[model samples]
Target: MAVDAAPRRTGTGTNQEGVRRHNLATMLRQVHLGGPTSRAELTAAMGLNRSTIGGLVTELTSLGLVTVGSAPAGPGGARGAGRPSPRVALAEAGPYVVAVDLGVDQVVVARVGLGGVVHERVRGPVDPDAEAWQVGAGIAALVRRVVRGAPAGAPLAGIGMSVPGLVRRSDGLVRLAPNLGWVDVSPGSIILAALGVDVPVSLANDADLGALAEHGRGVGVGIDDLIFVSGNVGVGAGVVAGGQRLEGSGGYAGEVGHMVFDPEGRDCHCGSRGCFETEVGAHAIAEAIGCPVDAVGSLGDVLDGYATPPPALHRIGHQLGEGLSGIVNAFNPQVVVLGGYFRALHRLVPGDIAAGVHARTLPAPLESLVLSQPGLGADSILLGAAEMALEPLLADPVAGLQASLAEASSRLAG
Candidate 1:
């Protein structure tokens, strides 16, 4: 995924060291996103002169974060083209981050490199009702297994986790997760204790991570203002406004599923009656299809038959669009992305959702809104988690790398 543009200098008298670090990060980000760009391309994208680009490239190459090499051949043979431009790209052996995506029924762990590539991954099912510590221990084991499989010379930057709950940004505590039956749990601490490591751990809402993944690497790459709706056992949303995540006062801005929709509808796990989640959540969809709540695989099998969509799937799609209309009216986002089960439902009944949104939303926002499915599929949360873990390193590569290396050394020594 491409990094956001470098922050403009606000005033003169900026610290020279800080400026150099920022410039270095900008160049690395350009390579991370575009892949093996030539010096001229970096100059244009970063708005820096040739000398500055060359110096930054040299520094990054020495630090082992990037490599300067010859660009690939074009459509024509070497005889038909000018001399190839020298290109800069992220090194294959660059540092990586461990990404964890904790869902209600499964946990996914991945080792991801700088350019948003997953080098290795491991995933398995977990009991949703397991004790918090047990869940943490399971995840920690998975993380260790993935870490052990990393390429030999690549340093581990950090760990990032996507939890299906309300996370306290201050301390990486999971405040609430109705589907997982967790409350006031500190999964990060548990995992750290289990692994006995001294690395940074970041925690965020799963839907929020999904939004970040879509914005950075998936379908919403260049679109700044958009909403990512994650529909799993429960529903949630991640909002991006003006190219920034709208995390709100206490990181609770995107809990759109809890909004009261039908006062007379079914009750939700969050203690609300007829909330939006109760209408379109996985359990609700399962009930509509007369299947058990844990019958997700079976549900997919049934949905596979709905290529022409029977009435049931169509109604679900319509309800989803109806719920999304309120969000579109409020946020006026440029796009609305459906993830997880919602993406599956859309595949079954795309036209119904479009019609429902058209019927309910106002013309102004509706005119510009594009409905989309996640490009990263089930891996969006994991990829986004890696991005969060890698941000500090991207901001100040040298310090971040040194700190990570020191931590790794301490772990080995102990």
Candidate 2:
């Protein structure tokens, strides 16, 4: 779990008791990110006065959302003149969310607590050709397996899913996941139906979530302009500009993979010729490396162990850079993260990609550009999903907790 890079600025809570829910949620978010912060630190970071911060912490304590430690909790653990502010940390037995990263070759389900803690997780292979319902059912099973180990009273929050496709932002409908052979599938609904649970579920494109996680807590922390390029079965990106997502009108903004790389090169699954994905996606990399196409989905680990660079790999690296140039020119991001198999690719050909982007990008965009790998490794999308799932609770803790408790009671009664 990673600490939030930038804390929210809405903590100067109002004096009105009606808005206590907002103040409590704000306080919880602070502890979840800052980790075991003191009353003094919370005041400074959240812009709330000491008494207001104290009152909110007390309420969260009653709800089992956080616990006060006995140790000195001064900033950096230094003691002050007066008695030290109580050390506030996320409760060890607090609520948890289910986070699923559905991939072409693998699926990861995790029980994630506040402060980004992964209490338990399950990961395994999935057939790309499997029906969406079958895959969703299997993922529900994985979710159940992962959450079995949570502390007894830890309530189940919402579920958030990440898929490598164009997900309709408004409805969690997966419009097209060509690599998975899915079209207009509602993965969230299927998983909830499979689990027979009443909790809410949300889904989003994997690349977009990857960028969200990175910008919020990973290597792209504090970077307002970033591009997270995912090299799963396809080549796609998540863009953040001015600290917000750059989703297009149709929620298909970052389809750089389908952008024309070479009009005459290769045919793409999306009925296009010479799309960028056709030249440098997982299959292309596998073919270039002389491996079976079926094994392409899980090639990151295999490709990473190459101590001696293969000629095919070097060529693919050049192709990767050539393809990225167009994206770099258009986004003008401060950071471009190479995720999934691209991480391994970057390790093999950092220079070629850098040179290619530099050669193609306009002078202004290239000046502050940085090419980096995902700090969370394979967990970027997974954690991003967790972040999304926990949004409800973080926004309004009272309502979120009440909903979970009511659902739990109903399950037991039934």
Candidate 3:
């Protein structure tokens, strides 16, 4: 009989110092995700000894990334033989990022700190006819407003932008944002030019960010497999399988709106006849609600105003479910989050949408499926953008902080 081998975890750290750094990152990530964690709990969660957890916590505290909390002892509360393990949390006044959710209808900018905390935020209307650079300038203004709230001595790690269209993952390049009327634009450099600041910048699809946020800290926190359906001006999706985002080749994976939804329904701006957006996008919803397309900012907000869902919304809800059914069959995610306008639709026509999904999805995938609204609500993409900006600091706290401080010093000198 052949002997079977147990599966091993990949990416075993090779260098001694590298392994230490990785452990530090792991500890920080645990505390960042779970908020304040006791030393004993960190040890248990990280599979590390208490002494190592204590050292990591101490270093993290010295680096200003984490703050130590009380060690009050109690039963079944990560207690130990000696004094209770101290609780560690992300420092409230440590580092932050400028996060921007640049939607076609509206834009939200915020200064976000670790542990998904929003220090301050500002919102602005996006003019559909405005140029991409103008939009960047507008976002820069919002960034300035939010930056005013940053604590003294806190480092601004970088900026992250959430766009409504395809963005190249290799570089924070906006390849095409049809809703924003942008193509091959560099919003990062534009904003930096407007602010005269030097910092790392990240841009990703809004739906992708929404999925990232929802998975990391929102409705799908405990669920590893989930899909986030975005119902902004268009229909798109962000897929997370096994707790990792599925950014396809060229990073244009989640363009469900362009998926041929209907063959004979209506002509889409993408030159396709009856694309998903044609049937279930903002225009379709606006048409159903008897509101002008321009009058709509957030589809969810618009739907929320109605006391009772209109009968026309039922058809849209069914269509939404049919679209999601395809996703459910393909991905078999544990949860499906309804974000953007779909949130309100899910709230109002839960039965209609649920019926369509259940009726169409494969039975097996349906067995472990759930339809949920984003727990973070409109802030999903905003926080997701922050997550992207904060990636560097989370990866290596010491080096990341040093670089951010140097950049901030350079900005001040200039």
Candidate 4:
């Protein structure tokens, strides 16, 4: 059990009392990122009074989330010309976040702390063709391995898992995943029951989680409207609009893989032919190049051979772009991010895709559309899952932050 990254300090019990604590915690996190600061700096940044900041800092120091050290004189001088000031910094104590990215062939787990540092990680293999229950067992086993490696008795605040399929997130049940041969499996509950601890678990499509992870800290940081195009066993896209992942009525909003590309093209497992996935997904690339699906490295590697781009790669990129053209024209997003297993167009496809988008879409909609890859690589899904678990906490923070801090305090007190 890893300690909660933002643990709830036990001292604050109720909402009214915890409001000040919540404000202080947020301010301290800001200070940790921005560096040591004075009461004046905290006041301006957090819109809190000097007394409030002082009391909050005291509580934080006692809970080991902040530390006090000597501070230089103010912009002017100390009190009059002889007083010394003290500075507070975020304490590097407590638990951390546990995130797992479960793929058809592998599962990766990571521990992330405050300041967004991935402190530790573990990776293991899974059968791409395994049954849903077996896959759940593998994921559960991998998570336990990661948790046990943490410092003894560390308490975890939450756990998030990314699966390669459509997910009913409210209950952590995976509805469908053709590549993994799974259907109607409740992986979140299985993992939780196996771990024997009650904590929030978030389950989502791997590509969507990957997009969120990258957008949260990587390439799409400042952008509000973006689309993540993931090309793997099957092609999929995760749309982000108004700064949030778009979950359709049933949480299957971005199943771009099923969109028909060519009515007469190769048939897909989803009972569709000439689908975007039929021409651009990993299976298609493997079929085009004459290799087993499992042997293909990644999209980046598949397109590395030709001195000049190969026709097959370009054709695939072009068709993939064509598929995206509709999405761009319809959504008119600020950027489109490419991930998954597309080897040929990690960078080149965006321009080609944008060209198709421009030709099909109104000029105004295509004016500043940018296409790019996630700054974070394959590990994005793991980090994204951790982030999803923390979102509810980040939203309100007061009650949740107190709960996390209190859990950490109880563990420490014991």
Q: Give TM per candidate.
A: 0.93, 0.91, 0.92, 0.81
> Where does candidate 3 stray beyond 4 Å?
1-13, 71-85, 406-414
Predicted candidate 2 versus true structure: per-residue lDDT over 79-113, tens digit per residue:
75775556889999888888999889889888899
TM-score of model 4 (CA atoms): 0.81
Q: Write the per-residue lDDT of candidate 4 for residues 1-414, one digit (tens) a residue.
A: 111223334555545555654675576456534566666677667766689778877866665556777776555664544445677765454445678877666678876654455767888777766666676676666666655555544445567788778988567678998777777888887766655556777788877887787677767877788888776567778888888888887787788888887898988898868888888788776766666667653444655554565555656666777788888887888988887665246554445555555566677877888877677765666777887766654443344455553343233223
Sequence-dependent TM-score of model 3: 0.92
Residues 211-294, candidate 1: write the lDDT tens digits: 998998898889999899987678899999998999977787799899998999887788889999988888778888776768
Angstrom error of the Cα, residue 184, model 2: value is 0.9
lDDT to native, each model: 0.83, 0.83, 0.84, 0.68
Better of 1 and 2 by TM-score: 1
Greater lDDT among 2 and 3 belongs to 3
lDDT per residue as tens, model 3, 4-76: 1112233773666676677777777777778887777776677776787788888998988898877665666
Error of 3 at 241 (Å): 1.5
RMSD (Å) per prediction: 2.8, 4.0, 4.5, 6.3
Instruction: Give candidate 1's error at residue 369 in angstroms.
Output: 0.8
